[model samples]
Target: MPASRTERLLNLLIALLNTKYGLRRSELRETVYRDVSGNDSSFGRMFERDKADLRHFGFDVETVTDLGWSEDDPATTRYRIGKESNRLPEVELSPGEWTVILLASQLWERAALGTAAANALRKLQASSRLTDVELPVGVQPRIKPAGRAFDDLVAAMHAQHPVSFSYLAGSTGKDEQRTVEPWGLGSRFGQWYLAGYDRIRQAPRYFRLSRLTSAVTVLAKENYAPPKHFNIRAELDRLPELPLLTAHVDVRAGRLLGLRQRALAGTEGHTHTPDAGYDRLDVQYRDVEVLAEELASYGPDAMAVAPGELIAAVTRRLRAAADFCAAPVPAIAFHDQPRAGNVRKRTSEDQLKRMLQLVPFLVHNQGLHIQDVAERFGVSREELEEDLQILICSGLPEGYPDDLLDIQWEDDHVYITQDLDLKRPVRFTVEEACALLTGLETLNGLPELAEGGALESVTLKLMAAAGEEGLRAGSLAGPAVGPADRATLDLVRQAVSSRSQLHLVYLSPQGDRVSERDVDPLRLYSLDNTWYFEAYCHSAQGLRNFRLDRVQELQPNGNPATAALEPNEGFPAKLFTPNDDDTIVTVQLTRQGTGLADDYYAERTSELPDGGLLAEIRFGNTAWLPMFVAQHGGSVRILEPRELADQSRAWIEASLASYGG
Candidate 1:
């Protein structure tokens, strides 16, 4: 039978590790390569690729050439993994440290780091020597590094390659092609930024991920090294905020309360068009494009009167939205793909990766309960026994009793007598290091978790253990969501813990008014960078979520919580709870707005030919549909409930007509 890739790699690793003197090409070909059939040239190429793959996994596969040779000769070169270099140094973690790590590893919910974090946690669990302890569940915070650009940049940084993308310059509002050596990606002020050397400008620059107008093209042929000891957060913090520009806008009377709230109190003036039912307001903004997008979302309710660029931008969006909503869409053939089963199927490679760490772990900690080991590895007891069975038969090339790994599980207690040269776990790979380190730093920002100095201590220890490459891999940093909303979160947490009713001065989502209410806090959770508190409100007589940022004041109402309610198990993960009365609306999403399906929890979705999406989503009412369409610019267009689409088109056309479109 032809040997599987997993079996071949394992046998080769064992043969190389067991050799005192490195094995030459011919010797390896006769041994581990015996099952692999190929010509000499093919074998040579395959061996080199395998060696590189091992190196990529942080295994130090060293090549020893003939003595006195100036250059490596393929015939004379021998390869082996040095025991001291390949094995990870023993890491001891306290219970507090372990608990913090567990929390940090769960920080990345949907980002590229999510998978990396899970794998890192598994390896850590295998090697952990600390006693297991449970932690009290609190607000489960998560950071979502959304968008394809984030994934592309992270991959490029891992490979030490440059990236090319067309960036929309915030200052000029023009698209410019940029080649950047992505040194680090971090978030600041609720937005993701890439700090790198701009090859086009021949200088260091920070580019916001949102402004990237095209798909990122990784320049694999080109590579560059980042500055040593670079601190991404520090550099991003050093950047000055953009200068604010004053913009004059007209708001239809009794509409766009959110825009009116930001208006200069004493700067109210007469509208340019008399009897147009408009109120003039002066507003301060940083970027014209950003402000334009916001103003455009109000449709006919708001219009930028001054700043020709702002007017032009808003006009362009309104025109596009009007046309998009009025256009007809072809009938879509909807089909549902079979959902994957809950049970995970373990592949040979997965089994191999686990066993590689499992043997070393068993060696260090002997006679562990079989169930305990199974739980740690997230596998069934039978599956774990299968792993042990396979492991006992795998060993050095020489088929001898003493050459193989000895493992036995009598009385449901497992022990490993021999582990060959794999007495320690392998060092952390780049992705593994990045996931943990970045997660630790992100967790450091939470006010609740930051009270104890354990987070900082763990971070320092991880960085030291990670070494140079690991430290560099931690280039992605999440936005700081704790500081600004710290006070509000502290109060909400206290209320939830005490089961006390609290008085709150909160602004309504529509921004039309502010209301005072006494509520019982149920849970505190976050999405992206915003903090939300789910509670039962006395005024509304039902459950409601209040944004921490929108709270004007919070105080104890001097009453024990009267409402008898329990938070759902999945409350923290869900942003919206559907109601029977909710309207089901269908909309078309452009390529750029496809993320909305996941964000809004679409009921159904179908892919369109032009990389767009046809999504059926539910909304509380049709009142917000026009704003949703305008907010996403032309990326989303209403397609169903024909009346709603007509209303949206009319709303946008009215806005454009005001701008003389």
Candidate 2:
């Protein structure tokens, strides 16, 4: 009826002839035009029309004699299309090419694709007739840029024009107005960076597009010339390596030593000779403060050996940290404090009541297990189970078969075998939204998170959930917390979750101190108006704790997770005890000495029952014990351990005799 339809029919006939070799007129009528009104046309007219269409369109349709039919019985005429009809070539693609095609199809969003590129891909896929294989769940490509900044930059590059933007240097907290000659945009390590010459620095610099606050096209035109000496791969090779700083100092030989060797290999130019019994290693970095902070994490084992300048820099930082620790603690504020009128409105009885309201939907809709759901929602498995039991009793229609509830449990696993008419999808409450927004906003301020848009998306979602009016009202309500504390909290949370040891410079009553420790992070909780990490220390090889407010710097230790502990093990709950027949060390103290001992041993000291000061202490190694005891002077005396007593008395006598006391 229409030119397009006639053309399609002719193509279909040609395809059939090529595939089936030949088709009888009766068979063609049944298969091709079975439900069409024109199929009843006289055989002679249909044959004439077919012949006219084929000849007009340059198709070679021909008649072939039926060998089994006699001349008198002319009922078996057969038609065929030319061999040229089947001449389409087979399409072949290499693995790499196929990979590129698939990547282009999946990762590059519609806005990023050119019309030609998109059309070509679709045509190629149709012609090839490739099998559609399903990608595994959560196998999404990491190609979404922060927003449209990257896409716009790419468009500018294609148009061969310069671009202007305000950029922030992460290394130095400096904002510079910059204009760059367009070169090219490329992706490296899951980040999109634009490589071009900086108009201000007069050198080649790369700007991560995601970090660009504002960017626009510039009218300036410049010849495109890549620097002869520029080699992106070579420059990337010299970028600073992530420093490995840990608190647990172990000198055992084997893979641990190998790891230390690898960490210090190229940086040996900065090390000095070992200080007597102690081995010394120095690492030079562009950021000495960062390196010093890393070294201080090693505590007693790794000291910042030299380059007085770096040590001074670290010392300056430690001073600032001490100031923070000395500052008065802030008051804890709670949201939605119970009002006088609302006391009788009734609230959830306990954490169990909250869990009961939250668990069933998470199990059935989110497909989460009891343990995972517990960790994510910050609850326990027992609490989750209690909620599930309550949920099992909640259903419509009141009884047995008519009830809208069904659950199946097998091998310690649970499944919601039937649907329940739940009205709402899981969501965060207003207070939860506020907390999440504040946390994400804090994370977004960190240097490490600046390159990833994940935090930005989270912030937007939080704001949307708060509603426009509520968000505006909250913003006007003034600041609830500062960014520095938030950053510290985020870093500690990451370290704990990752199970990586940390290097921190801790400010104690005794000047600035640095320590590296292998910590079995048990919990992070606030105590006595300060934040503290309760952990099992590998260096001390005992249960130890540290004040977060005193922590100045934090760094990751790049050792295997298993190397730090036995698999799936938790921190010991009790205080450490010395072995039997081990030297029992006792110390006696005078009035002034009592205060010092009490301050140091406040948590572990016993009253002695007889109203005497006989404080007991244990040491894994006694090399430095004498020096520590001698520091207390005349007010201190050893009460037990004959050898240690004699050693300490001799050291004290020697010091006093030198002073002519």
Candidate 3:
């Protein structure tokens, strides 16, 4: 059921729309009475309030006066809203705007709002002439969140009913049944969390989706009223933090000193065993998951020796990493991942995004250097010119000189002489606004876009343009972006476009040392949830992939950067190089390891009995291979490249020696 106010207002609309001539106050009382009070004065006040609301929503409540029926019947005695005015005006969406809406709608796939998003998309598409811009590739707007637990919680929220589920407590390492009135659901980092009123604690609690063990079931029949001023985001921000615990980790050699500096001081207790070529330090950590990520990233250089949960978490993280590495590559598709061979005809989406952005930008700024515009938009100068060429002949309907946009480009400078009524940026439809709002919230937690300060400004502008509908679009659950990560990415992007060199203090997990180097940056890409930048290092003098998380400090230099290497230039023909120095390690996979094949591309594979797999895998560094192989532990076994097996045993021996076991 809709809100009481909503239901009553809808009824009012229906009653007014149905009555052709007019309805007297007595007749309207019979038509709609669910929200009417028994007192005549109160009912009269309610009717007057309803009339005002209808007018606010653009409905014109007209009065039909009778000369004989005056004095006794007041001005509002016989009232009816005009049949035409009761219906909303048709909403018009530009092709680019429609494309954005379509992409935004896709972000909610398999999520709680999936149905509504789909419905909204279908309606927009039906009203639009947009068949040319539905291709995928460049227009991938997605935040992956799924499972029945998420679905059930969404249902409970919509129904305003209480929900019950079995939650595994990370601190106690135990499971408990919990009843909560779910206030909101969102994703932070790489996990989904539900904020709600907990019956057990009699306070709001946050539950991680991964910790949920049982099916979420609605426990209440009647709808419960939500707090009028309950703020989901504010409530989530108030969740109690876990108490700090000590993580005993063994650091080999002089490695991972950067980790000690980055995490709070004193957390790395000054305890050492110099003779053993390692140190046994007690690092204070509030969260095992975060600590585990740090330890796992160090590969064989660092080992969590104590606090079984921390050790287990490290092992889990490593296993997940190995699984990701072993997973097979997905085949490209037309409406999906773009592959050169499988590429489809270009769509209007990209052109539209560029045009929409450019028109507004040009309208605001009279003239700009062409190069600067290209850099700001993350496009090549040629691409910007091409877009301008298309825009010069583009206008309202046909390509008439006055109807078309008036733009001038001379000597690497461009100016918009006249907008031709395309002055301000296109206003977003309610669906488009909702889509943008949801996308903006989901982007809030991303480390790249989050800290750049650009998204926030864009969000403010979008909100102002979107009005109330955009404000009420609600929140989308997605991995929260970190500010630092976003800042780092933004800095790197600036360095990339300016052709400037960068001084980076990079920590190597395998080398176990913090090294400073100058690099010429290239493009940025994401693997899993982590961001990586492909750049040429002045020290290494080769192309290398740097994970954003491991970049401790970056100071950009003014040295002119080099041109990017062409595709298949100074690199292998395939996506990755298969050099003669590379190790070919073969393994027999247990059922769990078989999934790795699904995640990674295999050079060769053979079937086996008992649903197992025999596969050969390639590796650039066998030293790091041991940690990954050991991560899978018994589930994955090495059958070739005996050196890798030896290395795994060596790391294990070192770990045991550190603990004196």
Candidate 4:
């Protein structure tokens, strides 16, 4: 139902407070309730009712005392919402800002704020008189939350309480307990993180809420204080200042490592010892684990220089990963394995038939280089080149003669000539269909997959192919799992694909509400069984992550990318190379953190002094890693990069507020 006049008046009052700092009696009489009603005689009674309503709604409104011009001047008075209100300013948002808000709202819904944020957005739109604005064509906005657990975490945050949840450390099949005082919710690079005090290790931790299994608010409202001297912004700036770990390896034997370093160099930091050997060169990185992983492809030729702990950690993690790769799978007879006879093959021609299917992937990746195409199909350069040639030759019934299939090659680069019709019929073999179904099943479990109907439609197609006869023959005819809420998922997917911004009516962890944000969509990933969207947030003007389920309504608007993509002029080239000392660090991990060690180090392993693993890692930004370790409850520790260790300690201490202790 639409709000009553009184409710509208209340909203107007709040808006007035946000805009003018405070409202005077005369101003209130002249403009406050103009949109709702013009009854001046009842203004006094309305004011009393408004104050009562605001207080009832838990708003801390205050009246300041005028010291000098009092009794003689008819007692001038002004009213304003208190500091606790944390109300944002009231201003006209550009179309770009609206796009950001819409995107944020969609992500917020996935974090479990769908209903609340949606209602709030409606209210905001109504109040802003923006209900009739039409979005530009080709603009779509969508946001899908990570999951129910993430929602619970957001709720707990707003309640200002501790929360307990389970998280998978790495690819390992182990789960651990984590308790934290919710600090703030943020999105980075399309992933959402809950920054707070990790109670287990007594440090400030950033937990990827999407990775959490289950979350619930603790009854305790502990008074957790942030560090007096700690500043997140400062910490972010100093991230690239950490020292690098150096190593030497044979270039031929370590060709992969050399290539990775070459790619990473100039972006991070690296220096090559050219005379070390024809195929051997010395390399440096900020983190040993990262270096170990890069060099793992070279086998024994990659040797660590110092930081004995990193050497041990890299070795252990690589061995474990190798073991996983070598682990035997249960051997089943050909007859025992699921099968179908005389099925068709999934040719590239078949893929061209589904125009919608191709459009999303194509648009998602604006340009496709030869290397990118090769990686996507796991094919050789020659094979990808041939495919591109074939694509250039293929097309639909004419619209523009050059519309469907056109390619331009320049200096070894490839560009698409035109749009795809996406209406082609792609045939798949029975076995191929089954394999596709299985893949879809796995993707269904991901949080982001929920937003794109492509997955759902694929599943339905798989079911149809399975057929009633196949069902009678004991073949599964439906998806193993049910579909998620479609409307919500569709909203988020559209927003992301269309690059439209959003307005988020988000419910903070402290139960307070906010309804403004401008977010740039980057990538959507699944971690710990949930979905998260990492993006550049215009509100914070830095990279942030968002939980999709918390998002609400996703409106569309025209806006260019919030931040411009500049050439690598001032880009941290040193950070990308092994030469920069800031890129290397040693991390100590217990046996339990071996999975984390392996993931970062990929193929490197090292033994630690304390019978643990000291994994070396090379990283550009320390922002995400600290939060990752904190979520592990001290299982992983920053052995080197002293600044990071100190920051972690300060964060924990601040979260463990001395509640009269």
Candidate 5:
């Protein structure tokens, strides 16, 4: 492996950051470059390259001449990061804006967090408020998430390198080796896809990360230029939504009824046979294979009446499943489990991004307390110091010290003197923009916003700030919260802010029950594009979250005087707090289930040699464990937490029994 020039420069930077009087060249060689010190000429060349590197990274390194130190010795020179040019000015951010920024950071799961998202968050948090902010709940907007090979792909793109990987072709369902020059990444329907020039196919193609069957390996150092007009968003939209095919089935009131209700309003018809009891069922599907599996679970109760292929597909699947169940299989011991593995390693992208943001902040806002800065970034004071040390050599080219970034500090207070390229602030990535725009839309639909106010202007300005690309984010299609939901949101916001009570009818998530109750509204928020009304429920006498969509009716009533609890003082914080106690579960996945590993198991998953996934997941609670495992079917096996296996198995049995399969 080659020497880490990034590390060598970082060492030199730390030495410079730690002292008022910068160290001499002789001192740097003895300390930072000690292992491989060269003669004077070679060392000089190395120092020049290091300076140029720093300058290229936007550091402003300045050298001061020591003209008359002593008559007996030749005058020497010293270097230091100046305090004025390098620090960012104090940034202005609203509490609402800060919370939205925080939410935007959640667009990706674990593996994706370390890239651009992490960096932007570090910068936003450095100067933004940490608390006393009202957060809009559950409004997660994901765009081009960095899934499994996200980091590697980004590195290859940045370094201008080609990458090779095993891809499972969507049409063929076969793994094929591919070499591609990645152009850009995009997202549609909440899944990530990579657009690249496929060398093997000799065409530009988009690959879904979920379908990738192997680790991405960067090929030898050869760069390919992207087409001048290449645009990820445009190409992503060009993927075209396939037309939904209409399928006629025979079924009556049951799970099929629920599916019918979810379909487009006009696409329903029935045979209306009283004696047979099976109604002629009609449903539309974009993917016949997936739809067929779902229909097969309904057994003889549901049958595809027309579209011979659809009937054949469903029959084929049902027969295959029956054959599997009929065959005998050996049972394994209950305790058979793989040994625990190390936690997933976080990518270095986050650290690099933080430094970029930190530089502008230090330049603009000088003399900030180190501890305070650390708290803003959710990092320890020691970690902050270490980051600063690494930033010392973060400038232009190594030998080109003319534009070096100058970092300065006096004990607890930090100062930036000269920052060449670090002064300009970082821009929001496309994903961040999508999330922020979606959050703004939620706020835009409020009744207060409809009446023409500050929010209206904010909506227009924010969307405008997003540019064309923001408007083009396909996953953000259609209004997330329509006028009806917004109207409810407005009333709920009023109740929360005014400390009033609300009388409303709410349907349970299972849709089996509905009841009217009085609630003291606490917060009106959205989660994952779904609006939720959280409040102190008088009926339950505790804090509860109600999905706004399930809320059938709402009427505001009572005043602050009628409130059961005082504002900010007696508010039950625990009522809405999520549990932190964890239960660890180990699971082994077949090749088919490996794709979801990057999504749900990014922090705890390890890749198996057979392109499967070895995941040890930690659940905050096991309430959803059974259902979650059941969703993936037999391809995913729960290996640990013996109780989980039993529960999941029981749930699967019950589900099958309910379907009469």
Candidate 6:
């Protein structure tokens, strides 16, 4: 018996799978788990845990009890992994289905779901052949299920359990603890939402991920199953739209560039101040609280001059920020959560998973070079050798040479002499099915990619293969970021396909400046709900990214692109590209605003005594510092760069003074 837990699990799995009649507990303890030096009770607990672990890896461990005329017989129970129930059935995917699968797998970048999608793809790849499908370049569409809430919510949904979390009610502007049975998670209007039954309110409610004010607590004791045939898209679509209201805001001159872009033309009223000048504009808003949050984030630079509700809301938040900043530091700092599990334990789990796929892959592609095999699995040659050694030692308990899996890699080429019975990859679990299928569903909205209804066809086929459990995919969804302007998207795609330059009249968000430029199209991609394309601007003579919606005019220049195309292979995960000369500003984040640390790519962070986080983040310039502070309300406070901090404080104070604060 091996000392390694991973090896023991592997041997146990082989023995269970190969057994004709299931192996009894006593038989398993004697042959497969001979290393168990503890008492009978300890062995029973360990066996139970191992069985649960195997189930976690998507393998069904079937239990058969020898009943004497239907009477109970726990002592005669046996365990085995039934081949028919465990192995993945033959899956035949069309060329189009394969293409969408490839695209869907690439959609999740660095998010937790990315791993599940990748594993699902690998199993499908191992089971079926792939057709050559060229994915769109520069058009990298990605979905980031951000925050710990998303991770916890997904787990809860998978477990069919209720969850309790602190959520800020938008209408009342207060945090409330709500117990909810999460039914579905999806994106609508550029934000992630959890659709669930609120137990406290006794009604179905939709929760925006951002408004969650605390960590989600999964109520495992209270389990639930979503209503049959509940469609998340339809539910989200049924949400009512808020009435739009016009806000009269006064912004300091040459500031609040983002707000300025949304301002109505010819409505700018000018006012002079001792320190600066102000321009008043009419801005359309759907929610007072949402608008107030934005205005308050701008600190003293922008003021909600009209609409009593907006003004009151903004003032209250500013006062809160003031009070929060002046509060005493906490006496103790929070301990950090472990970033990962034990190194050896994780490595063993990874190896076990990789070996499960390796057996089937090697069976299909025999006598491949050892190095090639290692490269295919993204492992070093030495690591591959270690895995191969483990495989040769794994098999039945008969102790015959034929009982063990036979392999040879001495000649730099590898071959499986006798694969006991791991010829097919395991079936997809509910989580894996959800990750891939939900991603494909999001792509269905894009008519261009759904050519000939390939996306739909593929989805149906994969769902059928995954069985009834796969339908639970409707519980999770991505934001539907379809082409806002098909005409514009079509032209951009054509220009890139033809390798031609495009002349465009574009709006620059920096200072509300409109300009004409010729650009060589590089890639077209999307973040959340907006589409953007990266290109080489002939006018700027450098690389730039342009939002599709901001293009007022676009036409091909009818000339070949002079600049070589260097399409970025991966999505630009960062919104603000840092440079060597970027300014490093330090700030303190209240518990609610700690998420900003990841959002802004904080270079360094430390726990503050007051249950807050101190983060050092880089900015290209300090022009937006005041706006940043105001945007987060009182949740973030600038700590360093005394000059900037003073300016932000003065800005807030000035705005508060206008409301007689």
**Which window of 10 residues has the lowest lDDT sum in candidate 2?**
472-481
The lDDT values for all models are 0.76, 0.43, 0.59, 0.43, 0.57, 0.77
Write model 5 residue lDDT over 1-661, tens digit each, in one string: 1225655765555445444676667777766677765687798788778766555443556675576563223126666655444433334555655555454454332333333445545544444424466544323333333334765675676455899998867576557999999877654543467888999999988887655656788875688776664657667667876477787776655434455554554434544442266555557777555566566555544566667776665555444343322333323232323322113332344455466678767765689898987865556688788778767655533335644567877888999887665555444455544445444443443343345454445445545544543453332321223334567777787777677788998775333356898988775544334566567787877567787777888997664525565333221121123233667677666555554554443235655556656676566656555545544434465656777766665655554443444
Report how far residue 43 has shifted in candidate 1, in Å: 2.3
Give a tens-digit lDDT track for model 1, residues 1-661: 1226666777778888888779988888987788788899999898887777677656788788888763357677888888777656556788888888877776775566765676677666556675585543345677767465787789898898999998878677778999999989998766689999998899999998867766688999988888886878778778787688889887889876666777888654544652379878889988666788888888777888888888877876787677777677867655643221111124676677777878777876789999998876757898898888777877777568988889999999998888887777777777778888887887777766788877878877777777875767547777775636677788888888999999999877565578999999888777666888888999989788888888888999899999999875452355666566888788898765666776666777777777667877788768878788887667788877888887787777777888888
- Against the true structure, candidate 3 reaches a TM-score of 0.48
RMSD of each: 5.1, 27.0, 14.9, 27.7, 9.4, 5.0
Answer with 1 or 3, whichever has the higher lDDT. 1
Of candidate 1, the 10-residue stretch with the lowest lDDT total is 336-345
Return the top candidate by lDDT: 6
Off by over 4 Å in 6: 1-3, 69-74, 137-139, 265-276, 287-297, 306-351, 365-393, 405-418, 510-516, 539-541, 570-661
Whichever of 1 and 6 has more lDDT, that candidate is 6
Better of 3 and 4 by lDDT: 3
- Candidate 2 residues 1-661, lDDT tens each? 3433343343334334443356556656654444445534565466567666544333456666578675333357666665543222223444433433443333332223222223233323323433454332111121233234544554555444667887756566445778886554543433445777777788877776534544354544654454443433345335454344422122222212322542443334433444454444333355444454444322233434355544444343333233322333232222332221101112223332243224334433344455764553434677566556655554432235535345544454556754342212222322233233333432332343445554455345335534521242121011111233656656666766677666565544232235666565544533112346655577777556566766667665664233344312222111223444445466654322343333333223333322223455555445545545543333345555667766655544443332233
Point out the higher-scoring one by lDDT: 1 or 4.
1
Those runs of model 2 whose alpha carbons end farther than 4 Å from true positions after fitting are 1-360, 363-382, 397-400, 423-427, 468-507, 510-563, 566-661
Measured with C-alpha atoms, the lDDT of residue 16 in candidate 3 is 65
208-270 per-residue lDDT for model 6 (tens digits): 876776768889888887899777878888877767788888888987666888898866443
Query: Is candidate 4 or 6 superior in TM-score?
Result: 6
Error of 1 at 281 (Å): 2.7
**Per-prediction TM-score:** 0.80, 0.28, 0.48, 0.28, 0.60, 0.83
Candidate 5, number of clashes: 55
